[model samples]
Target: MAFFQLWNSDHGHVLEACKDSLKKLQLDYLDLYLVHFPVATKHTGVGTTSSAVDDEGVLEIDTTISLEATWHDMEDLVSKGLARSIGISNYDIFLTRDCLAYSKIKPAVNQIETHPYFQRESLVKFCKKHGVSVTAHTPLGGSAANTEWFGSVSCLDDDVLKGLAAKYKKTPAQIALRWGIQRDTVVIPKSSKVERLKENFEVSDFELTKEDMELIKGMDRKYRTNQPANFWGVDLYA
Candidate 1:
């Protein structure tokens, strides 16, 4: 599972809490641990609050803590046998480059919002160049938590996606997910619905054609459903 919002002040506490949770849950250890954001924020239970915003509205930025410090703490977790591997989530290319420059242990994965509309080719390429795996969150477009952006994007409702879905005998969401897999990225489409969960995992059996992939790629409108830019000026990645 991914671990986010860890830092020096509470890094040890967070690590211990995770260990206890894993023990209680009867899991041997997490396959991967991720710093959810580059910055720190007020924690409310298991979630965090942010003041980040963009042209659309307010959003949370990364924490004020340095990324290197966070990485150090993460590496400590590995050394102490708390996590098998550590990585980052929602990090931009610039911050990722900084991490690469100073990190003792390079991130094994970089999880970000990736879909046909916002494929993030440059960032993906940067991570690949540094031997970091790219994992796509919201691979089937944005989640229901932020329907405004997702609702505005016509790709989800486009006749092209619809026609392609018909051709592949799959849902539009499934087709979108297949695109990510074909691009060689791990896709995580969150849904508590059991049927949808099964459907999301079932894409492994079929394949999208080269023409199909190109058609989907050409549909990019640079639409990002999640943008917590309010903390842009902060030294979260330092």
Candidate 2:
């Protein structure tokens, strides 16, 4: 549902990406389509998405493309019936505000990294207040990415999460995800294990008490586990 090349928003490949995804997915139309990131980069190859980088490995960015222009194309996709809904990802309030200001078809969702560690309450509040639904992408705090990529701490292992898990009789991950859902955000937790997947689905059965919510809220480290700067050389979140 997300295009990889929102970096070069000015090059105008929204239709091509949508069609390519449809063909690959074997679908006639997508339920929702989203711009993966706000930054636009020049295409590295035709019919392929490549992140063009300089010798220093900094991502090549194009400033000529306006988000409004690209968003208009997104609106076109909705009008053309290629996608039922259109949204943005990794956008904070300022960029989201800009999209809302210029958009004829307002964004329905904003997907961002949200978990106990980096709650991003202000941004979530802003989006919800303006009718933008939030989708939480690293609802468990990017444990895999943290361990494999950054060698950083995972929110799932936090003492607070452990305490809550013990209190709720749930896994730490379940508690973290439950907290996010209770915050009125949709959580898309990534897991390959069948049992783990089932466990994630089971969070809807229990509601965290207000006292427990406050306890988990106090665990915010403002820590982001997926810092791609190590490889991309540019911190996209930065």
Query: What would you estimate as the lDDT of candidate 1?
Result: 0.73
Per-residue lDDT over 171-204 for candidate 2, one digit per residue giving the tens place of the 0 to 100 score: 9999999999999999999888999899999998
- TM-score for each of the candidates: 0.80, 0.93
Mark the regions of model 2 whose C-alpha exceeds 4 Å error after superposition: 1-11, 46-49
lDDT by residue for model 1 (169-216), tens: 998888988889989899988888999899888887799999999999
Error at 11, model 1, angstroms: 6.1
For model 1 the TM-score comes to 0.80
Candidate 2: residue pairs that collide? 7-39, 7-40, 7-41, 8-40, 8-41
lDDT against the true structure, each candidate: 0.73, 0.84
